[model samples]
Target: MDCYKKSNIEDLKAKNSYKIDLLDYSLFITFFPQLIAGPIVHHKEMMPQFHSLLNKEKALINWEFMAKGLFIFSIGLFKKVFIADSFAAWANAGFTLAQNGGTLNIFEAWVTSLSYTFQLYFDFSGYCDMAIGLALFFGIVLPINFNSPYKALNIADFWRRWHITLGRFLKDYLYIPLGGNRVSKIINLRNLFIVAFLSGVWHGAGWGFVIWGSLHAIAMVSHRIYSFLAIGKSFLNSKIYKIFAWLLTFNFLNIAWVFFRSENLSGAINILKAMFGITWVELPYKFKASWLFREIGGNDKMVGFILISFIICLCFRNSIQMLDNFKPNIKNSIIIMLFLYIALIMIGVTPYTEFIYFNF
Candidate 1:
């Protein structure tokens, strides 16, 4: 509402000074492609484009743009249908096992957390890609939302990469309005906490969500303090130090995901207990020989998949990067079409699964 009001006021001020059509203004607010899960378009960015005569003409019959949009959309569909949905079952099973009085062993705990981590990432990022691609088909360029967030070495860096539009909205509408860094350090910390807490609550209704948000808040505050003290400056500059920092940030994110995925506070605590080796059980030989072996085998596959995803996220170019350097060639088109074919087949076989961010 605040963002809307601010934009509305600015638009009215501009209208009084210069001529602008109402249809363009309406389209700027109701742009269909980005309406579902936003890259949060701003009026200034969108309004000018609506007035572009060249863009309007090009959008009607741009074969090159259409091909690029299709390619990007195919990748997103593959990510959501083939990869994210594959992990959903494993994640659900792990969490359900814990809730059903089954002991959540260390392996199960990690598997559940990791599955959900990848699931959420691919699911949300996939949607973002599709939205951006759709917008491009209409000659509209929405802001990039995901930028290989798993590669981030610190919590602060993670926020910058992940759900970038939402972060921008919060920074502009909440943090800045709350005095931001213009105030004393203590007040700045207060603003951070409030924003984080609201962010958590905005995700869902639960104490686990609050705790997840609080965990991030605490991490951000600690990072700020560390920066102020200039602690371990030399270490921070080293490659080895960056690897350690990435590990720490990634693990912290996984831990918070446990809370986010859990049904309740106790459910989250139980998973955390299993993760930390505070829960244990001994199964009979027959049971261990049969079900335990199968479970371990499944977990091994999941671990392999997670590691592959991590590599892709950390070492390879993201969708946006690929799109930027894209060249439409026969070989590339064939590969993309093949992937899209597989994704369509998978979609046929799998039951429909909603993107994780829909609830938010």
Candidate 2:
């Protein structure tokens, strides 16, 4: 339920401190439901909805949308509780160990990296799902965020599918305006690099992020060349090429995750070095299974849970597509009820954080 507002600050600058109209902006930012994490809302999306709410002279009160919203919210809750947070606890421990260095094992680093990757995805995407669901509950549709990004065959495709709103903002507000692909080849490459570097900074104010962005830019450019040479002029509709593309894309993204997950360039370097058999050492402390379950509420018994949730999340093209295939009778009813029960169980647990994207 992310919402954005156009600031009136431009007009008020002359007055230095003009009285502000808090209604629309407040509604946009502090709309109780989406006040936490967001779809990274834009000014273009919020104003119209705010005006519509005001014109109708009512707050949200539609039951059908509300029910669907509740269901989606519940599903998001399960993803956060049953999946993301659980992974986060373990991943955080692994990341903490990685940060300490000198006592990190290669196996540990790999596990932690993979765990963090899962935690990052589910944590962020679960929040986005909740946001989208909440928005729809109010009869507004927020942009979709995750679309099996793990399956993407290139950085460009991954960007198109993952964190789509942020990608849109970067492209619209940053990339295109910075002479995107319209100049000489050298300038175009420079612009792409500049846009990517800025995008990394936008993700975080650190050198690690900068490197992450740079790596992505390089990967994207390489993929563009590959696409032009391989897919663009090819008459072969071969499955082998498709598989190769997917393999290349996934590996590139996985490699970049080192920088994205690292606390700093040194940490990323150490991890990369470890990947190349630099060294391995035991941690001063051992990880605990009990702590893991206790922290996330002692329900890791079912491996099927994670696999099923991921399958459901990944297999569907979009929510509309999911709903289209959904049976409205006993099957759908059962699924909805099961989701509701799981959501309630999760709610009974300890506190939870909002999606990871709020920082952006």
Candidate 3:
């Protein structure tokens, strides 16, 4: 907007730009698929599509796109209602315990942290999937937003995979404007830190969010330094080294999520304490949440779900992959129908839970 408002006619022509009518600008801003949460699309990406659609193209909806969009939307609904919300209960109970000054056993603490971790993965992945699907319904293809970020072997790679469009926006707008990697190493690192810090603030206005950003910044900067030094570059190809690297990255993200999920600093510390083997059985308000898995009568179901979900997150083909390999057969149609039917039933039967990004 500033570019259009401030640029002279010559500058506008150079970029193949012109003033946008208010109606089209509003359409761009209010595109329902990404209005709330987004893939952070650019004007160039959206405007041309809008112009084409308005010029007698809007009526020509591609049946193939509509079918694929519904399929993707159904898959996303299952991810949110069935998978993400299933974990939300455990995560919420654990955080509530800490917030109320209740303590937790080490097992409970780990459960809480890991619950939120997986919950977040599925929740956001579902939202972006739905956004992409909905856009497809209108014959518009939004960018890929999430891409198995938990499978990343390093913090930098995590950013590359997770919330991909947001990362792209930051890299192009903030990181580059702050000099990007072309600058001196120190300044480059500083730019990196600034991008991460603003990313934290973007999530919410809280100290815990700031700390979450700081933890990520530290890890990213450390990784950058490691890469700069080129330590063990040759050994990095070994299976053992790769496994060690993956473990380090995954565990770091899991721990960092405690701060992100906590209601306050003290709550985060208690969970961290228990996670690291400090049992919380002695606190004044001991964490006695028999309801933690009351419906299931134990943590067995939760544990199994976490493991299976983790494996799926790590090993299964993502939605895009499935879509690419899609074949319209009786089996595929039946699966999609089952997902939609189950999701609709859940929506009608269960209490509503907001999407995680709703807070953001």
Q: If scored against the real structure, what TM-score would every candidate get?
A: 0.88, 0.78, 0.89
Q: What is the lDDT of residue 329 in candidate 2?
A: 59
For residues 65-99, could you state the per-residue lDDT of candidate 2 as single tens digits?
56566666666766777677666665666555556
lDDT of each: 0.78, 0.64, 0.82
Candidate 2 at 197: error in angstroms?
Answer: 1.5
Ranking according to lDDT, highest score first: 3, 1, 2
Clashing pairs in 2: 1-131
Candidate with better TM-score, 1 vs 2: 1
Superposition error at 257 for model 3 (Å): 0.8
Q: List the pairs of residues colliding in candidate 1.
A: none
Give each prediction's root-mean-square deviation over alpha carbons.
5.0, 6.9, 5.9
**Which consecutive 10 residues in model 3 have the weakest lDDT in total?**
1-10
Instruction: Report the C-alpha lDDT of model 1 over 1-360, residue by residue, as the tens digit.
Output: 121234643653364433557876777768888887787766765665455534473356556667777788888888899889988878887777766656666766787788889999999999888887787687666677888999998898999999988898899999999999999999998998888878888787788888888988888888887777846777779999998999999999999999888887677777789888898754335543234424433545566778888887889999888887667789879978987999999999998999888877
lDDT by residue for model 3 (198-257), tens? 888889999999999999988888889988875676688888898999999999999999
